[model samples]
Target: MDEAVKFHFVVDGNDFTSAGQASVQIKKNLRQLGIAPEIIRKVSIAMYEGEINMVIHAGGGEADVLIYENRIEIILTDNGPGIANIDLAMQEGFSTAPDNIRSLGFGAGMGLPNMKRYTDAMQIDSTFGKGTRISMTVNL
Candidate 1:
């Protein structure tokens, strides 16, 4: 492709049922673009995790996907209470999700870790009480 293809989505914070819509759509779009299944899988997983995080923590957010020749990038931005300790947040099995959220089997503290594990590169920018932005890339 001469130019990167971009897709944007707005995640609804109040609706847990609709959290993963963006990632599902992205997976379909990537498949139509002839992206490899593995790459698509990685991108979808990372994007989904980010989306869920936005819904669970941030009151809602925006997700953007850029499809380039060599890589696919997913950017998630949220304006909720930002992560206070990114280091602790990244640790496995560490979560601040409410007991109600846990009852729904949503927050397992694996979102950030899984996002990083699935993507070739990941970066997180967060400000306490402000917001957070996460960018992840998967190589084709």
Candidate 2:
């Protein structure tokens, strides 16, 4: 596409049923734009993880996606308690999710790591008591 297209969503915290809605919508949007299926899958997976993380830990948040000629950009921001240790949080299988969350099979401590893995570039900005803002880009 010659022009960039943007989409936005509001995530509802602690709402398991609605957690992946943004990703699903994004997937549809990408498909409608004729983006490659593989690319759509990767973007959907990454954004879904981020949305789940926001619900489980961040008490909900906002997600924005921009589709451009050369890349897809995603931004997730939340006012929930920020991650205490970025390095530790990035480690696979390392999670602080509550027991109730684990019972639902939602928190495997794989969110951030997977987000980074799927995206071409990822960045995290957070503070202990403040909040977190994550930005990710996947090359087209």
Residue ranges of candidate 1 with Cα displaced over 4 Å: none
Best by lDDT: 2
Q: How does each model score on lDDT?
A: 0.93, 0.93
Model 1, residue 49: what's the lDDT?
A: 90
For residues 1-140, write the lDDT of model 2, one tens digit per residue. 37779999999996787789999999999999999998998899999999999998889999999888899999999999999999999999999999988998967889899999999999999999999999999999
**RMSD in Å for candidate 2, one decimal?**
1.5
Model 1 lDDT vs. the true structure? 0.93
Q: Give each model's clash number.
A: 0, 0
**Model 2 poorest 10 in a row by lDDT:** 1-10
Tell me the tens digit of each residue's lDDT in model 1 across 1-140: 35889999999999998889999999999999999899989999999999989988998899999988888889999999999999999999999988888998977999999999999999999999999999998988
